[model samples]
Structures are given as structure tokens and as C-alpha cells.
Target: MHKITIMQMLEKYPELPPISQGTVSKIEKQFRKRGHVRQLKKNPPNKLSDDQKLDVTLMLEENPHTSSCQTTSALNISHSPFSAY
Candidate 1:
């Protein structure tokens, strides 16, 4: 019938491991803001689409030992994606 505070929940559950109050508050705040407890999806710095990866693979297979600069120039892709290989 009563809502339990974060400290009370921690106190009631002896099986629960101890954590910093600050950490717990931060996590609770994040859950309230996001409506979920999971971490946010991280965007890769230089993510390549599946199609682009396949295209790069095929290009490399066709021209083995090709330089990264050459591959980028040939595929019209940026140096970052080519350098990832």
C-alpha cells in the first residue's frame, strides 16, 4: 500500500549486493528518463551497412592486395571505411 524509497528497497533486500547511493540514484534517474533500464544504443563511429561491406569484400576479392587509397577511390567510399579493413 506504500511506495518504497530506493534506500528502503536496498535495506529490505539483504541478498542484494551493496552499491553506492549515487550510482543507484543515477541508474534510477536514467530509468525514469528513458522508460527502460537498458543502456542506450551506441552509434558506431564508422559503421558500414551490410551492402557496403559486401561491396567492399567483393572489390577486395576481385583485386587482392589493393591499397586502401585505391580501394576507396575505386569504390567511391571515404578513407575511414576503407581504413577499417
Candidate 2:
């Protein structure tokens, strides 16, 4: 069995737009793993639970002047949990 090189594959398809060797390798790896590569993987987002949301909301209501950094730090969170969602 002959293993085709990335450069060889790229040369075989001149119609393809310019792409990096690393990108080719990633595409080949994805294709081999999933049998196709056109569709992307959609992972579930990381969001706060209902209870966590309530806690944040209540905290904000109690102290409207709290800075973003102070709020996150006080809640023991590294990032702004509500902003991402």
C-alpha cells in the first residue's frame, strides 16, 4: 500500500485554491475519521445552570454598582459566564 504525500495530493488537484500543508493534513485526518469533512462538528455550548443564573441575577440586583471583574471574582468564575451565551 502506498501512502500519498500531502504535496502530491495538492499537485494532483491544480484547480484547488492555494492551501497550507497543515490544513491539508487536518482535512485528510477529519475525512478519515468521519468518512466526510464538509459538515463541521457542533458541540453544545457551556452555559450556566438555572440556579447559577438566579445567583448572578440576585447578586446584580443586590449590588448594581459591582464591576464585571469583581462580580466574576466574587462568584469564583474565571470568565463572564453570562456574556458568552
Candidate 3:
């Protein structure tokens, strides 16, 4: 409500984490502008490109029984993506 204070808003939404008045104001402004509050997509710096992913899939198809570590080592890629599978 226009008449409600920030403290009143906080009390009304007790489930929300403790936040600064500035943060709450920013959130309210963003919601008013966009009609929703959601974080922007953040792509991982080391995420494989489409070509790299295709290469990995082809490698996996060729050697279906290879361990994740072995496959990563053979492909010269980090273990994170391979381990995710």
C-alpha cells in the first residue's frame, strides 16, 4: 500500500530474509518495471560450446564404456562436465 512503511512490508512478509531498505526499494522498483523478480541467466565461464558438446557426445558414442575421468582426460576437458553425466 502507498501508506505502508518498509518495516510494515517486512513484517507483512515475515518469510523473506532480512534485507536493507535500499534493497527492498530496488526490488519494489524492479517488480513495478518488469512485473516479476528473477535473476538474469549466468552462463558458466567454462561451459562447453555446442561443437564441444557434440564432440563429447560423439566420443561417448564411440566408447560407451569409458569412465568419466578417462573420457575427460582423453578429450583434454575438465572433469566437471563429464562428471555431471
Using lDDT, give the best candidate's number.
Answer: 3
List residue ranges in candidate 1 displaced over 4 A. 1-44
Write the number of the candidate with greater lDDT, choosing between 1 and 2: 1
Worst 10 residues of 1 by lDDT: 1-10
Tens digits of per-residue lDDT, candidate 1, 1-85, equal: 1124555767888688755667777778888899988977898768677887888899889988988788778877788866775
TM values, all candidates: 0.44, 0.46, 0.44
Give per-residue CA lDDT, model 2, range 1-85, as digits (tens).
1135655756888788656667767888888999998888697766877876777778899999987677777877646466763
What is the per-residue lDDT of model 3 for residues 1-85, given as tens digits with 9 covering 90 to 100? 4336566867888898656777777888999998998986888756676776887899889989988778778878888765654
Local distance difference test values of all predictions, in order: 0.75, 0.73, 0.76
Looking at model 1, residue 58 earns an lDDT score of 93
The candidate with the higher TM-score, 2 or 3, is: 2
How many backbone collisions does model 1 have? 0
Q: Would you list the clashing residue pairs of candidate 3? A: none
Clashes of each: 0, 0, 0
